[model samples]
Target: MSAAHRPGLRVNAALIIPESELSWRFSRSSGPGGQGVNTADSRVELVWDVANSAILPTLQRERLFERLGGRLVDGVLTIAASEHRAQLRNRDAARERLATLVADALRPPAPPRRATKVSRGAKERRLTAKKQRTDVKRLRRPPTD
Candidate 1:
């Protein structure tokens, strides 16, 4: 982030990443820009180095890296936005995406589920239903001579 930009990005109330750590690049977007599409650099690519982040807590940083390992390339994560026609909107979109990805990756994994046996009452109900079906089928057959 340059002196031109005052406010930094706010990922959450607890976590804030300084704009200085963020890198932005703009390119001619392949998306809608009417006749100006070829000339306008509306596409925004936001890159952040998670490995060297200063704001992230140690535990959360490890969890984020572990969870986002496949997405990160050489400890850097890049998000590109071209959905909007304006460069500012695309930049915002990219930053929002980055925040969401970081927040999701930092979350703890859900606990594993343990295998459970069928309850005794449920087993008994199943057997009773089978017995009723057998009785009904037997009644449906003609009397044996």
Candidate 2:
């Protein structure tokens, strides 16, 4: 089925953004369509208002704002696709891009790394290797009377 007919864009197992939340804007594409490039509106821009979406829970909404701050303008995220000559293909591309981007941003932050100290055995091995290297260099020097 075409992306236009889908009920919503599924960002993850828990988050599905309804079609009503997505808006599209199109314009003439800049490349590869030969004679049709100038007239065909193959470039697609998909915009979603992250701040106003009804589907998002409060925590998820705040996470989206925090993770996607650089990309969001007035709490809206926009995805653009122009690589395809067909409008429908461009639409699909834009949809996929939007889904991937939102999914990534919605992901939970990774747990903090725990600090670790070097093991005694590892420190001993390192010191042994250094001492071996020093002995080898001493052996290389010419013997004095």
Candidate 3:
């Protein structure tokens, strides 16, 4: 759906951040706009208040806090987009980026890894390879009696 008619930004099946919670800032982009670059505000910054959002579940909020700690400042998350020359495209890019980031943060953590030891056969093969390499190097040396 278009931004104008859309109710909120869909992060995942369980989460939809309302438009009211999103804020936008725009400035002239630094690259590739030719003459329009000077006059247009093509760079977009999309900010969301994750800590204060009404739509976030308790667990999701905690997960976001933990996963995005470096990115967030004072409980707010900001995403910037400037690759596009048009303001609308930059805005869309920012929104998509925010949604993806929030969805990843809300995902469950991976299961712990299980450690294992090398098999006896594998150890024997490795030893055999080392012996072969040593014999080859010894053969390359000149005979000394």
Per-residue alpha-carbon lDDT of model 1 for 40-125, expressed as tens digits?
89989999998898888889878878999998898888999999998888887898899898888766789999999999999999
lDDT of 2 by residue, 1-145 (tens): 9676799988889888999999999999896879999889999999999999998899999999999999999999999999989999989899889999989988889999999999999999999999999999999999999
- In terms of lDDT, model 2 sits at 0.92
For model 2, which pairs clash? none
Model 3, span 1-145: residue lDDT tens: 5777889999999788899999999998997879999999999999999889998878888999999999999999999999999889888999999989988888899999999999999999999999999999999999999
Better of 1 and 3 by TM-score: 3
Count of residue pairs whose backbone atoms collide, per candidate: 0, 0, 0
Q: Please list the C-alpha lDDT of all candidates, in the order they appear.
A: 0.86, 0.92, 0.92
* Cα lDDT, model 1, residue 31: 51
The TM-score, computed over Cα atoms with residue i paired to residue i, of candidate 1 is 0.80
Q: Which portions of model 2 miss their true places by more than 4 Å?
A: 140-145
